[model samples]
Target chain A: MLTGAETEVVLLSFQVAGWSVLVSVVPGILLGWLFARWHNPARALLQGLVMLPLVLPPVVTGYVLLWLLGRSGPLGSAWHSVTGGHIAYTTAACVIAAAIVGFPLMVEGIRLSVLGVDRRLEDVSRSLGRGRGATFLRVTLPLSLPGVVAGAVLSFARALGEFGATIVIAGNIEGQTRTIPVAVYTLLNAPGGEPGVMRLAGVSVAIALVALLVAFWLGARQRRRVSA
Target chain B: MIEMRTRHSVRGFTLDVHFESAGPVLGIFGASGSGKTTLLHCVAGLLKPRDARISVNTRMVCNRPGGTWVPPERRKCALVTQEPLLFPHLSTRGNLAYASGAKDALESDSGWKIVDVLRLKPLLDRNTASLSGGEKQRVALGRALLSKPEMLLLDEPTSSLDAELARDVLSLLLQVKLELKVPMLFVTHKAGELMALADDCVVLESGKVISQGAPVNVLSKPRAIGVANLVGVDNLLRLEVLRHDEAGGVTLLAMGADVALAAPLCASAPGKTVSVGLYADEVMLCLENPAGISARNALACDVTRISEMGHEVLVELKIGLQSLRARLTPSAAHELGLAQGTHVVALIKTSAIHMLG
Candidate 1:
């Protein structure tokens, strides 16, 4: 029963969040593993740097991304020279902003899960004639599946509701970068935009409820398997 | 041959020892914090020692001078830790196949052989989390065997199991040795398991090799009395198998000129000397031989030494040329006037003597 504009906003929101999670999952899992397994003095520093976006304001993060990717910036000038296109104020910018804001949640979920895995399991695997790499793929990764799944779902939900950063970097272009949250913000500011706001807010709650249910189901299943 | 001479020190606990073994199974016997597990870890290449030279079958796995080191996977020494760490993500069959690198090949002949020997066919498809402690240990052993390891290093593998389950696992290990013919290093604090599984033994105490020799020699030697007392088997006598009376279901053995004992049927031939184990707690000391007693063997012995150990008093007796240890309560010792140079009768039940192999 969504209007044409509402339907466009919904589809754009999914597109932006889907791209954001898809691009960040691999790097997020890698950072989680590095934090879990690597032993070094700088490990705390690296973890703090990755978690900075979780505490910093979304608008500030967006400004930093815009400064780095704007046409006048070094990377933006180099890209413009090669391809003659701008990166800021685009759909790509919205994906980048959402991914940056959601990355900490993803990495944190996976890191805690990875840390929960027993290190003695890896030693047993190695004694079974498997190398370190093979053991990671066979034992470590499989045991940490619940965390990975939870991380992906959380990052996806965070990206779907992103607002301040998306508007600051990507702007509220209709049918292009106007994600559901950005559209809802724009609608509430205009005269008599209350009904549209109610619809979009309802959709947001539905998505978040589904994501949370999925995470709970996965975590419970993992615990049952462990204690079976 | 497995030979290791190493020194490792960390956090006030150090392991410094040297020994060589050419037997099928070597026993590393010690108390809980005696560095036995650390020595096994070094032999398995799980941990590198500070100064060391480790060779297995003439191939140097770790050498300080040559700067050669082999990782655990390359060392081909399968370590079975005290906790049976089966992969919880996989089923019992999957864990065995994981070791063989055959994704779904449990139907293979070698796989079935291991499954059959371990009596694990009924548990093949079950998830490891569903298996009991003893069942999980069987699966762990099966997994290690399937990997075709050059040697097996067991770190108190049966310590977590109850006495019955521990005996079951130890019997299975003996079967594995018979079938697989693989060199193994069994580390344990139990004297019974050490006697059952190992031919040559090394005793470690506080990160040093206190005794190294045949199991009987090391366990019964006067210098290793502390080790023997720690293991709870204080009296280890060398008795020759004199004859067998199959009708009585017993084998008669000679302790000396006048002292003889009957044991449960063993496979030794006549005149073959065998070491018989007796726990100090099992021996009953009486000032006068009691008629109508259930115990069959009563030998006259002269007490050589007496020592107080908490509530119990350990009395060493000289039976012919051999020594026997008997534990008595302090009150009983005082009432019986048990002291060195006293004459006493050492009565032992026929079933209490365990044949050490």
Candidate 2:
């Protein structure tokens, strides 16, 4: 029963959340594994830096992203020198904001699962002639897979709900950056947008409920694998 | 074959060991925290010792302090720990074929032979979590063997099992030693396993090697008191078989000058030497030799030494040039008026002496 404009907002939300998860999955797993297995003295410091987004206010995180990607910023100037393009107030900016905001949840999920894996199983793999990378791919990665799936779904749900970072970095442009949360915010201020807000809010609740259920199922599966 | 010299310290505990063994199976024997597993880890390249040099089958695997240090994958030493450690997500077949070249090896004749030996054919498709302890261990053994390793590093592989399962695993290991002919560095605290499996043995106390030799020699005449304590036997001796009275179902072994001890009948021929183990608590002392005693050996002896341990007194007896230790309560020693240089009779039953091959 969604209007064409409302449908566009829903589709944009999915696209942004999908891209965020796609770009973040590899780096999330890498950081998660490093946090779980690395023994260096500096590991704690690096982990704290990764976990900063989880504790920092979302509006502040958006401001930091804007500073890093603004026209005069170091990386923004570098991108201008390389490709003659700007990154702010675009769909790409929306994806970056959402991905950054949801990153800590993803990494924590992966880190705990990787930590639950038995190091002795990895030792046996190595002794059986598998190198470190091979052992990770065959043994550690497979055993911790449920965690990775759960992390991705949870972060996707988090990205769909991301509003403060998106509003600051990407602005409220329809069909490009006005995702479900942003559209719902915009409709709340309009005189005849009450019905539209109700519809989008219902969709958001349904999507979030499904994501949480899947995450819980995957988490229980991971626990069983570990205990087995 | 392996040669190692290592010194590793963790917190306050240190492991310092040096030995070379040409082994079909070399057993490392020690009590817990005595560094048996540490030595194995150093050789397996799982732990980098502070100062170390290790070689397996004449190939130098590790040499620390600016020398060559090969990683674990290339060391060709497959380690099987007390826990089966099967990959929980993989089925038995998948775990058996997980190594780099293991898929082909599993199809090879030799690999199938390992499966046959371990009786893993029936359990191939089963999930690893569904297998029993013994079955999991068998699959683990097959998985290690499929790697085609130069040597197997077994860290008390059967210590986690019940006695019956342990015996079954030990016999399977014996078959692997004889039929497969793979060299092994077997670590265990069990003396029976060492005698059953090791060609050469090293006994460790605290961190250093207390004794090293053939299993029988090192165990029977444990040079250090730590070994005797670990072996859990108060008396270990080598005696020559005097005669076997099959009719009475007993073998007479010479204790010393003009003294004979009767043990359960064995297949050892007359005049052959055999190692024997006896516990001090099995020996009973009497003020005088009584008549019509069913206990086989009641030899007259002089108490050479008396030492009091917690809750018990140890009496050292001199019987025809051989020394025997007997355990008694303080009250028994007092009632019998026993002291150093006192005359007494040491009563030993026919089954009290255990023959150690």
Model 2 / residue B29 / CA error / Å = 0.8
Q: Of all true interface contacts, what fraction is found in model 1? A: 0.69
Off by over 4 Å in 2: B222-236, B243-251, B255-273, B277-357
Q: What is the lDDT of residue B161 in candidate 1?
A: 98
Give the docking tier of candidate 2.
medium
Estimate the TM-score of every prediction. 0.84, 0.85
DockQ of each: 0.51, 0.77
Which candidate leads the pack in DockQ?
2
Q: Can you write out model 2's per-residue Cα lDDT over A1-228, one digit (the tens) per residue? A: 899999999999999999999999999999999999999999999988888888888888888988898788787778889999988888999999999988888998999999999998998898999999999999999999999999999999999999988898899999899999999999999999999999999999999999999999999999987987
Looking at candidate 2 chain B, the ten consecutive residues that score lowest on lDDT are B224-233
* lDDT measured at residue B210 in model 2 versus the true structure, 0 to 100: 85
Deviation of model 2 at B195, angstroms: 0.6
Winner by lDDT: 2
User: Per-residue lDDT for A117 in model 2?
Assistant: 97
The number of the candidate with the highest TM-score is 2
